[model samples]
Target chain A: MEQDLSAPGILTSQLDQAIGWARKYSIFQYPFVTACCGMEFMSVACSHYDIDRFGAGFPRFSPRQADVLMVVGTISHKIAPVLRRIYDQMAAPKWVVAFGVCTCTGGFYDNYATVQGIDTILPVDLYIPGCPPRPETVLEGLMLLQKKIQAQGRRA
Target chain B: MDLAPILSDIEALCGAPLSARGAGSDTVLTVPPAKARAAVEFLKAKHGFNVLVDLTCVDYQGFGKGTQNVSPAPEGRRFKLVYRLMALDAGTGLIKARLALDSWVDGESVPATIKDLFPAADWLEREVWDMFGVRFADRPDVKRILMYPEFTGHPLRKDYPIKKRQPLIGPADASARERLSPADLRPRIVE
Candidate 1:
């Protein structure tokens, strides 16, 4: 009684793969830039390095609209609550990238003021290790995140 | 600029002789806690020390021991409050005045605030109060500036445990009935 939508030479794939592919390609990032690493983040997102090629150039300031949280610098104990609040506010199906060595492990700030690592406050997906990672390193980190998204999709 | 005249003026105004150290433009005046405010006021009003560059507190604990071999502080006088004042007059390129309040302590013997004379001393005094537990009398707003309100014990104190971690979970209410003390909140020392 009804015509088949998938006829003849139609290619089929799992819903998870389709969703994963879509999600990976269009990652709207929310940059929680605090310190010096912000300069590197700017360079990576700007025209020369062009993070847009990977479809992650648009930096959404609001957490609600963002799919990825790129923590770009040192997270002090004083600022930890603020970081946690922003992470909690972001919609589900979100990922976090610790952009700098400071964000990854508090760098050399082994003091009362600095939080040892951001992972203690928020779950981190990937860590791009550098004082401030080069633009290429950031791009690689983005690619890794894409792969992670794809793998997570398969598992889901 | 000659600081002898200014030093004399400060000594006359405060009615106490200040122990001066260093020579030339880098003179440091060690004023008693009781007369620090008056001396600072005189310097600000007359000597053109308009900018309150910095106000910081130092704990003389464990002095004359370990790596730093220096003379220990006088009995019951554990702290020293240092005030750095700068005069940015057009004629004189930049004049720095260092005032040290020796025989100072946290609560009762702490120096008075110079916020009335130099408005910039407000935040610096608040910071000193926050870090060293030093009370600035006549300062209306003495709340903690660097550390959170719920934070117990000043971190900068010499006795504060270095590895002690205080991880706060949620937003702290100012008027919360139950508050955790330093002993209760400190991390358990594992063997």
Candidate 2:
């Protein structure tokens, strides 16, 4: 009704909500796969999992082009600097998902080489548990990210 | 050949080992620090033990506690450096022989670098140094191959704490340059 007379055919919605809705749908994700959890990540992207339905099928290999950083495996201290650099290179309005137990709390590798968790270096958005989380769990995590994208209204 | 005879004829191949003994089915030669390089050189020149399969260190700080990995360091040496050598028959493309060289490694003594004898020993020696704090004399360059340069101690040493972490960039060593992720954006752990 607000747009009935002045702007016919125009739908009315809050500016932030409209923006959030659009941003949440077109997710540009970067897969930072380092170890075994990468297997689950690969299956999630296959035909069976069908991640494209959520509008995140395309993977942007370049850090700058992506909005989501899917850290899918163990992050060793030797590679910590490189991970930090990749996280720094990504543009703002970005989110990180710790996609396995190792990335969440260093899994069972609570030793000298592995970083306790990636969160110590990068700002993480979601943590999907499981040794290598099942594809279903990854989908759930992705949906939660979409919700968070809508809730907080992260950078346009 | 089963390689068992080579153990007996080892003196004919490369002089007598400090203590020639069999570890399981394989032959192990314990040589003094001064003779390690020469023994490996002899094995390569005459016996076709050309490949340096692995070179590693074992710190026996508490061998009596958990003595499974290796027999207590020979000759009262706290650190024992093991060099694994392999020889492959060229035409057959099959392993011809395998010999392990054991030598005394101590903090005061520097082991001779064998990179010249086996080109592959370049990285393996560096790894041994990186993980066990053992350095080789006459090595062209010494750098940490697995751990970062800033890493302080050799992690595999029995004395080194397992939980010790030397992160180059993180909350542990956060500087302005490394504080890339905004603190305010650190997402709350959601159940």
Candidate 3:
């Protein structure tokens, strides 16, 4: 069994490709929604914008089942520890997407209450830059994430 | 029914104000420390000023230029408390008799609390206490309303730098090992 594990050939490579392709399609997301961008996320998740085309429409509220962490709004310093804790609780091979300008760069709240950017605490995968990114932009970001997942997947 | 009679009644309780302004039917009065609560109690009982809209504090250390109707304060008297009260009028919903009670207190002195009169003053005073670090003389609880208990300085004070942050944990804390990453929790080190 150990010799077979050590040997990397066509069969294992084909299995890796199959796994990556499967992972790229079906994504269970955990939305860490805090402020206004949550409204846009709801619009994108609901029937109007329809996020189901990307196969990531179903949201897992619990962090354990989710592979993607979509942080949806302003993350204040008061809530930063909680955000960090939630990120830590999610299983490995998890990706974090900063949803708005506030989560991306703290927007206009350059004060005591707001965290300047989320990257200071947790490592971020992609940043969707807007006060609230439009639904079309969100779909684009989702596609970008799928590409990222595909690239990162073959390693497993 | 009129503001004059109400002002006279308030003045009878708390002597004359430091500065008084009459903007329409409302009265904006800046009273002395101890007498303001008496006047508020009287207004609630006698007049129809039942609603305590807000109880807030302002740190005037580097107070900027103001509007035409500005109340002047003495030197070293930095913190000013503003209490807004409203009367529920039948004709105009809830703003028939709006009274703004403004008072100055040094950072060291504790002002007499009107929380006994208005239940809303409990949270409002606590919010002021949390933001400006001003304490009321006879308040019930000493909990911080907006900021956490571990938070040191008041964030809303004029002297407080806008960008200065006192975080509860992580990034800035010395013992930041409490915060864990995905790499930290892995069963084995990845080659």
TM-score of each: 0.84, 0.85, 0.86
Looking at model 2, what is the TM-score of chain A?
0.89
Q: Give the fraction of true interface contacts kept by model 2.
A: 0.48
lDDT of 2 by residue, A1-156 (tens): 554553542343355577778778988999999999999999998889989899888899999999888899999988888888898899988888998878877777878888777878777888887788889888888888888888766353
Q: Candidate 3 lDDT, tens digit per residue, B141-184? A: 67898777778888888888765777655455322233223343
lDDT of 3 at A115: 74
Q: What is the lDDT of residue B109 in candidate 2?
A: 78
lDDT of 3: 0.78
* Candidate 2 residue-wise lDDT at A44: 95
What tens-digit string does per-residue lDDT give for candidate 1 at A98-140?
8877876677776667777677677788877787888888888
Q: Which ranges of candidate 3 are over 4 A from the true structure?
A: A1-8, A154-156, B65-71, B89-95, B173-191
Interface RMSD of 3: 9.9
Name every residue pair that clashes in candidate 2: none
Q: Give the CA lDDT, 0 to 100, for residue A53 in model 1.
A: 91
Whole-model Cα lDDT of every candidate shown, in order: 0.76, 0.79, 0.78
lDDT of 2 at B178: 25
- Total clashing pairs in model 2: 0
Check candidate 1 and list the clashing pairs: none
Name model 2 segments beyond 4 Å from true. Answer: A1-13, A154-156, B2-5, B12-18, B23-25, B66-71, B173-191
Listed per model in order, the count of residue pairs whose N, CA or C atoms clash below 3 Å is 0, 0, 0
* Candidate 1 TM-score over all chains jointly: 0.84
